[model samples]
Target chain A: MVRPGGRSARVQASVHAAVRELEAEVGREALTVPLVATRAGVTPSTIYRRWGDLQELLSDVAVERLRPETAPEDKGSLRSDLEAWAEQFLEEMSAPTGRAYIRDALLGGPDGTNAGQCSAYAAEQIDVILDRAADREENAPDVETVLDRVVAPMMYRILFRPEGLDTAYARQLAVGLVGSNDR
Target chain B: MVRPGGRSARVQASVHAAVRELEAEVGREALTVPLVATRAGVTPSTIYRRWGDLQELLSDVAVERLRPETAPEDKGSLRSDLEAWAEQFLEEMSAPTGRAYIRDALLGGPDGTNAGQCSAYAAEQIDVILDRAADREENAPDVETVLDRVVAPMMYRILFRPEGLDTAYARQLAVGLVGSNDR
Candidate 1:
């Protein structure tokens, strides 16, 4: 079965299972190849052959978590679209696992390149929100600035602190960011 | 000299020298107390006697780097104050060592507490701009949003990339962020 071929379905399944187990036990730090192999009952060489290193494996895993569910589908108006976007960001801030993954990505260790991936994800999300305000081209800068300053900080405060994401704060951010008129 | 006594000037100098050398050589990862002591030509006992551990030593070094320069005496208007802030931020982004130190402080290590120190530094810098805006509190939130989205990213791009700090981009960010006010 091991004739210099790609990983078998069974092997892939085992590796996926091992990654979850390792993450649960020691978080991102323990996602090393040797650890994953040991947990999966596979040799280190098998992992190395399938995925070059832990980063490649972790990148794949991290990408899987990048769901676009938060990007509003057609909120009818620019204001509502922005509110939805801010709400999604707040949801991410409230979830411990979401915060942990972000911190891990930013920490830039064995998986430092993950920062770029995460940044790209954020940029894309921002693009979607900005798209709604494009017809009112004068509002582009204001929309972008609000998203970064007000909306973004709400996520950041909760991410860095032990406190839960505050709904009132999120509401304040959305309204202030998407003010009644153009900048 | 190594006995239990009050801290001395010579010991402080050695610690600073050790920190500078440690950061120059291996960034922040290899900044252990033993490593600092060996490089400083001081015994580990002497080093340990001075600072509790790597974190304590690093935090002190960070504080020294964060001492604020005097803000412009009077930049004429709020726009000028913001433009000056962007220029100052750009200057720090221009230095390779400064950029690396800030990144490490912000992203932090495997433990994740270092980022907090970095955030505090950023908050202080942001406060300076905020206080300046408070001088004319009409559009403080708007000013802050611009700083967060535009000025901050320009610094990050310039510092972390091969392009170095972009003076033109800084100017654009400052101007765009605080457009020709209704004045």
Candidate 2:
């Protein structure tokens, strides 16, 4: 769908795209507003006047791009639903673009501002899966419980550990969380 | 306990201590070899000859410092053992010295070298707890499973989320991992 508004919206899109592209190319640490402006075909003055500084610009870009690209789908059971959600979540998180956004948000963007947005986006997607699962079962684990048991561990490995995350890892995690509750 | 070796051992201990002190003071980003050498009362040439780079030096110091201070005690059951381990782990990790070591390991040190050492250290401690629990009960969850269920999420929150980690969080995590297997 076409984004609303005219020149200003176009500029925003261009700048955001440029920031992501540069992040992918150079990594977040090497990113600069002047470099981003040059890539977006916008002036440094416009970037500075609009975003204030590199941290704010990165935060805004992360908030925009780090959201789930597509809505999570509902599967019949909680196990299947969680697995599907986690698979998609892991896939997005492991991608270069997603990695760039997360790296910047965690490392460079202001305190919790951008990182919280990323966490919120994941939580929102997980909530959709959990809600669907609750309809089929007598009881469903709360979001915080699910987060602590499943999502947080997966995220920790993704960000810190050298172990690779795949659909199998996602399935195991989903099974661990959901299977334990079967009794 | 007195570490073995002669002048080399003393020099190594002094240099490691200086690196930890400076890291706690200014953080890893502001750390430099010359600064560390000066603080350690050693020449820059000695530092360069010994470690080659700041990352190498930090990794060595991190490896030496990040080890668990003492063996985790066996607490009869998996739940109590895990809770005790997590409590000590969280307390150490949240301390300024622990935070400095972790920060340097995660951010400034080489790719997997130092970070892997830190992870291995935690894994070793967790293994001891799990082994004791296993002797008490058949089919105890393995270290990997326990880590995914208990430790990963806690570490994610500690490193990324703004929330403080306390003994209560540790107890909850231990319970979640151990209590689920009671079917």
Candidate 3:
């Protein structure tokens, strides 16, 4: 539901808190509109009016939780920074909790807004790395290219065939992109 | 439901027909077990017993539809063959219906069986191309590498950011895999 300005942060905060508590107590699958409303001491219509549905609310909450906690670690060279970031991304995104968040982010929206937001987060980090290389007069591909070559494959592996993934694989993707044998 | 041998092909055929018709008539979002059961002339319990839920049943139908209709076209060289196959794969998978099928195959179950089956179809085609290169005694990477470098990224792009994907992008992925530079 689109408000004239935006949703009230106060309501959002309490609802989100209720969702987290209910998710912990009863898990994600069992969450319902009435359950969340009762926990938050609001009517079910409040949730429906604000979020449209449970999946939408869940996606909103997941997107909030998935916001990057810190900037990508600086590891000197472009390749090293990308490799380190890629490794960390794979590690976190392949964990059970990370996997669930990814699913929640994607499966909640048919419009692709949440999924696109997640991708944008990765792109912002990639751009920071690219900007660093530019500052250092080092050659680095654009953010989209890195996303296509390095991050995309890793995400596919994470979401599907995760058996062959490792930090070495992450480093290999960075090397393929940079094309230097100095690793 | 796990039968002594397997589910009856007749029941499956009728149920699939009902689902397809209902999907066309009411669309996927409006589908329900009762609606499908009434259409198929079967009890709702039968559907639950057989497929566990509407999503699982939808996934099963999608998997059947997603099976490759023909082998990867033979283009006289491994590079050409792979390029041709990758272009076709990307084209089909990025289309609206293809995207729906991929989503159906994935979003149904946490068990990953349906998604794994779809990946297997792609892997089987990749192996056929690999076998041809091996028969010609040319240098070639393994199926896993092709999957990692080529298909995985393409899938990620299809599922997320599909703006930059095209036949040229598909060919470039093929070139990256088989780098003779004679294309």
Model 1 over residues A1-183: C-alpha lDDT tens digits?
333444586787788688877898897764689889999999999988887777666655654465455666556555666666667767775576776655445444342356556555656776776776785553654433553455446644543333444666566566666657433
lDDT score at residue B137, model 2, on the 0-100 scale: 72
**What is each candidate's DockQ, to 2 decimals?**
0.21, 0.45, 0.65
The true-versus-predicted C-alpha distance at residue A74 of model 1, in Å, is 4.0
lDDT of 2 by residue, A59-170 (tens): 6787687777777876677777788788877887877666656655765433556666777887888888777776766367888777777778777766567566687887
Q: Rank the candidates by TM-score, best first.
A: 3, 2, 1
| Residue-wise C-alpha lDDT for candidate 3, range B78-120, written one tens digit per residue | 8998899999999999888898898888876887777778889
User: Residue-wise lDDT of candidate 1 within B1-183, one digit each (tens)?
Assistant: 443343566677777788887787797776788888888778888866766667666755664575556644456566666666667767775565555555544443334455455445555665666676677663654533654555445533432222434566666666666666615
What's the lDDT for candidate 3? 0.85
Chain B structural similarity as TM-score, candidate 1: 0.63
Show where candidate 1 strays beyond 4 Å: A1-17, A26-32, A45-60, A67-73, A109-113, A126-165, A181-183, B1-13, B25-32, B41-63, B69-74, B94-96, B107-119, B122-165, B180-183
DockQ-derived CAPRI band for the predicted complex in model 1: incorrect
**Residue A27 lDDT in model 1?**
79
Tens-digit lDDT track for model 2 on B1-183?
A: 345787777878888989879877997779898899899999988888877788678767866788778879876777777878887777777666666566557654435466666778888988887777667774467877777767777776665664666778877877777776543
Question: Which numbered prediction scores highest in TM-score against the true structure?
Answer: 3
Specify the highest-lDDT model's number.
Answer: 3
* Structural similarity to truth (TM-score) of each candidate: 0.68, 0.78, 0.91
- Winner of 1 and 3 under DockQ: 3
Ten consecutive residues with minimal summed lDDT in candidate 3 chain B?
Answer: B1-10
Clashing pairs in 1: none
